[model samples]
Structures are given as C-alpha cells and as structure tokens.
Target: MKQSLLLITVVGLLLSSCSVSKSARGQRDLFSGTWSLDNISYENNSGNFKSVIFNDAEDICFEGSEWFFRDNNSTGRYTIAQSTLCNGGDRFFRWSVVEPSQNYSSQLQFKFIDENRKDISGGYGYRLNIVSLTEQAMTLKSNVSVDGQPVTIVYEFSKK
Candidate 1:
C-alpha cells in the first residue's frame, strides 16, 4: 500500500508540471490581438510619426503617417509564417524575434517593395528593432535612411 501511494503522488506531480507548461504556451499566444501606435520619438534625419494597428488575431493591418516628405502616409498588412512575420511577397520584408519578452530584441529586414503595384521592383532596403512586445502592445525602433540622410525613430504602440 505504501509503494502504491508513492507512485500515485509522483504521477500527480508530473501531471501538474505538464499543465503549467501548457499554460505558459497559452500566455505567449496572448499576443494575438489588435493594437495601435500611441507615441513616437525621432532623431537625426528622422522625425516623429504616428499610426494605428488593427490585428485580426492572424494578420496585422497598419495605417500610419511618417514624417518624410512625399511618403508620410502609409498602410500595410503582415502575416505570421512560422515564427517570422512577413509583409507582401517574399521580396517585401520579414522579421523574427530573438527572444520572447515584453522588452525583447528582434531583427527585421526590409525587402523593398514599390509604392505602386506597377513599380513593384523599385525600392530600398532597411532594418528595424522590435524593442518590446506584450499581449496589448509593442514598441519598435529603427534607423532608416530618408533620401541620403540616416535617422533614428522610436515607435510605441498600444492595444486598441
């Protein structure tokens, strides 16, 4: 009777541990939601801008205005493929998080896409930093070139 009780207790402990791990995975999925930009910080050739992000649990829709002349207003959508976030075609852009955290690091590669479908091959490449992420929001920073000048921009977003 004593040995049987010990085995039961060990199995119960293992089951509880497995449940805790499953809960953690569920927490990561909490990032699936809608969010909007709340603030921005600009430096160098970069100027402040704002936008609104609406995510439909799967894809993300973004409507924003930049500080650049002739390219201030923009809109786009991104989809999650595996662990990478992609926009447009394979030639457009993609991003991946290095670690998972509210204040984590990420790498982004800009695949230039044309502003108009007729000129889809005419664009430049760039990079961005995803500084943080949560179920309701995310913060990003990047140094980008406008014309011939490089500038740093910080963007903060919140759930809508």
Candidate 2:
C-alpha cells in the first residue's frame, strides 16, 4: 500500500508540471500568425499624453501596425506603414510569454533585433501586462508614471 501511494503521488506531481507547461505553450500557440494593432487607449484620464511608447515609436505610429509571430522559433516582426509623419519600417524581435504567478500577471515580452536577428537593445526589452488574450483578440497594458501619477496604456490587437 505504501509503495502504491508513493507511485501515485509521483505521477500526480509529474502531470501537474506538464499541465503548467502545456498552458504556457498553448498561449504561445494562440499568438502565432499575424495580428494588427487596432486601437490604443489610456486607462487613467490624466489629460496628459505620451508622445512615444516603448521609447521606440510614436504612440500614433503603432496603431495599424502589422505584427507577425512565429511560435515555433519564438521570432516575430512588426511593420509600421510609411506615412508622411511616421518613418515606417520592419522591426525584428524575439518574443516570449511569461507565465503568471501569485504576485504577478502574465506578461508579453519582446526585445528588438536587427534584420540579421541580432539584439540591438544591449539586452533590454519591453514587458507589458497581458490584460486579456483570446484566439481573436488580445489586450496588453503598460503602466507608466506621468507627472508623478500612475498611467496605463492599453494596446488592443486583433488577429488577421
């Protein structure tokens, strides 16, 4: 009886570990394919707006950007359309979904890379709180401080 109980416990533990990994993998799989940044809104009404986001591009430039994700290789790229105001181009990146824990929410993180897939940020990346994700839509939030007040930038994306 004792040996049987021990085996059962071991098996249960292994299964639980696999379950966690599977969930994370599933989330990544859902991110595969192309998505368009449809909308960007602010949570707090501070009457102040940020000109740039992620220190990469203007807030207006990200809207309508095309994002492509490859789950198998964990590689992706986003392209901003060229316009009179925006200097549009393609940006390569390595991305991952960070699993949630007791103290934190799930995060979407990505680091910019060059055309050759070389890290260009000197080991720096951006992490945004994944507010919601589904097969059709995903929302991410980035918290920042503006004038010593908390602000949240919400990014909404839809699969294409």
Candidate 3:
C-alpha cells in the first residue's frame, strides 16, 4: 500500500508539471506573430509624465511601432517607424513570459540584444505586467515612478 501511494503521488506531480509547461508553451504560441502597437495610455494620469520609455526612445515613438515575436526561439524585434522626432530603427531582444506567482502577476520580460544575439543592456532588462492577452489583442502595463508617485504606462497591441 505504501509503494502504491508513492507511485500515485509521483505520477501526479509529473502530470502537473507537464501541464504547466504546456500552458506556458501555449501562451508563447499566441505571441508568435507580428503585432502593431496601437495605442499607449497612462493609467495614473499624472501631468508629469516621463517622455522617455525603455531608456531607448520617446514614448510617442512606440505608438505605431511593429513588434515581432518568435515563439520557437524566444527572440523578437521591435521597429520604431512613426515619428520624425524619434530615430527609426529595429531593436532586438530575447523575451519570455514569466509564470505568475502568489505575489506577482504574469509578467513579460525581455532583455535587449544585438544583431549577433549578444546582450547589450549590461544585464539589465524590462518587466511588464501582462494585463490581458487574446488572439487579436494584448495589453501590457509597466509601473514607473514620476516625482515620487507611482504611474502605470499601458501598451496596447493588435496582432497582424
């Protein structure tokens, strides 16, 4: 009876692990496509909004940018092509969806890389809360501090 119980417990643990892996894979598959940044909004709505985002470009530049995600390799690129004020170019990054924990929501994290797949952010990365995701749309929110007040930058995307 003891051996049977142990076997059953082990099998249950293995099956649960497999299901979690499958779920993560499925989420990545949904993100494996070209997406257009449709809109960007502020949740806290502070007048003292930061102009720069990701320390790379102006927040306005990302509104109409293009993002490409490859689920198989966990690689992606984002193109900034909208504003004359912003330098238009492609930025490469390796991305992953972090599974949700008791204290945090499901997060989308990425680190900047070069064309040769080398790290460029000096071991720094960005994490955004995965607010919502669907076949046609996804929304991500990044929390920031401006003048000692918390602010949320919301990014909206549509699959293309």
Window of ten residues with lowest summed lDDT in model 2 = 45-54
> Which tens-of-lDDT digit does each residue in 38-151 have in candidate 1?
555667853544322211121222323211111112223233233343242212222122333475344333333434522243444344576666766667787655567776
TM-score for model 1?
0.37
- Model 3 clash pairs are none
Candidate 2's C-alpha runs over 4 A off are 1-20
- Residues 1-160, candidate 2: write the lDDT tens digits: 9999999999999988755466678889889999999998888765747568777788899999999999988899999999887889998999999899897798889998888888998999999998888999999999888778878899999999
Backbone clash tally (model 2): 0
lDDT of 2 at 76: 97
lDDT score of residue 20 within candidate 2: 41
Question: Any runs in candidate 1 off by more than 4 Å, and if so which?
Answer: 1-31, 44-104, 108-126, 145-150
lDDT tens per residue, model 3, 42-143: 888647454698999988888899999998778999999956689999999999988888977888899999998899999999999998889999999999
True-structure RMSD for candidate 1: 13.6
**How many residue-pair clashes does candidate 3 contain?**
0
Stronger candidate by TM-score (1 vs 2) = 2
lDDT of 1 at 33: 41
